[model samples]
Target: MVCLRERMKMGKRSEWVAFCFLCFSLSLQTIQGYKESETARTLKLEQGDAHEVHCSRERSKAAWKIIEEYLMPFVEEERYQISRRCRLHSDNDLYRDQEQHKIHVGVNEWQCGYCRKRFYGENYLDQHFDNRHYDLLNVSHSRCLADICGALHCDLVMDSVPRKTKCNPAAAAKNQHLCESLADTCFPVNGGPSAGRLHEFFLRQFCDAHTCTGGRKPFSRGHRKTRSIFYLFASILTLMLLALFYIFIYMHRRGMKGGTVELKRISKSVQKKKPS
Candidate 1:
């Protein structure tokens, strides 16, 4: 009996130890997985900047075809085709011919697939599609035709992708997790000489390439004083002018009332004297 009891106790202890080990191992695996996912989420993004990555589509016919194919599903297919074809015309022709043609075809509202808001004209619709639907940065505009797509900061691309380092140290320090570099990425559409400068100008305006260092300008001291003085002088001048006008009106009315009262009193006195 004693030997059997000791064996049972040992068995229970072994089982408890095995259970504790399994729990620890599972916990460690879960923790590791979580860290990896978190790292991936912030991997390319700089710290202080909005999360953005800049990817370029290789400048080839194949690339544009692929982008158009992917973009078709998220966009109204016929509308996109019209816009793409219109891009071939010179600016002058686009303004003169394309505008008239689009109007003749009927100015119709197109609803956004994501937001479901309708836009009035083709110009507004084109702007809406670019700003709302294909607004993501890291993924190729082609890749973003699908509903779930990554948004990369244009600033990140401006600072990191082309240079492969933070051009602005302050912005990088603030948003360390937000920047990623894509090497030798060429923007096919922008291969023209003017395209590079234009893109850089746009990137500076909208990208997270730098930190916002200065506050908005306050009202100037001279302007504030001038405004206050003008207000005070105007108020005093208005009161003085109002007082003069009021006095004139009161005097005019009082004189009229007095004259009428005097005339009635004199006529009554004269009649009373004669009738007696």
Candidate 2:
């Protein structure tokens, strides 16, 4: 019985030893994993800047064609201010002539799309348009067509299809993702002409305003300030016209009143006097 008891105690001790060994192995594995993770993190940090990759790529012609096909429609309608954000408003515009007016271009001459009037190089066409074709540019709102198409930032998703992509603001997750992707892709700090200067210019000009940078509004605060001034001017002009109308009416009524008093005095004199 004593031997049986000793054997049972030995068995219990062996089981306890096994449990302790198993727990020690688990703890050692956990510690090793934590140390490995720290080492990996330190190596990553030592590798230098995370976004040090300068953009050396240029978009293909097929990509540009896709962009043109998808975006040109919304750009034409009511946004002559399409320059720089959507694209530059220059001689290179695909459908520049079709804007409210038809533009005619010659070897060294630039003609007004609205009136066919001619101008010299660099066009100054926008100023001419704003001054003369003012009616076409004016709208209830000056928001970007991205407010409709949502393609301004999603040029990659836009280029996914060979021909064109539908301009749906609801393209979500995919639509909004490009803004951050483009900061690196479009024009990184290290980006230069070899990375594509024209391409860089295009991306910088177009994406800067459309991306999350510009409060996501195409029209800057300057547009708002100018719009407010325009409204103020219009209000003042309207008030002036109304005031002039009231003054004219008052003058006419006063003249009639004066004439009526004089007539009454003449009639009273005649009545008091003889037939002569």
Compose the digit string of candidate 1's lDDT tens values, residues 1-276. Answer: 999999999999999999999999999999999999898778645432342323232122222332233222222322222223222112212122212222212337655445556667666754654444443333322332111111123322223345444346565444322211110121122445433432332233223333444322111111111245558989999999999999999999999999999999999999999966
Q: Clash pairs of candidate 2?
A: 102-113
| C-alpha lDDT values of all predictions | 0.41, 0.49
* Model 2 lDDT-worst window of ten: 217-226
List TM-score per model, in order: 0.25, 0.27
State model 2's lDDT: 0.49
Compared with the true structure, model 2 gives a TM-score of: 0.27
Best by lDDT: 2
Model 2 alpha-carbon drift over 4 Å, by segment: 1-93, 96-149, 153-170, 181-248, 267-276
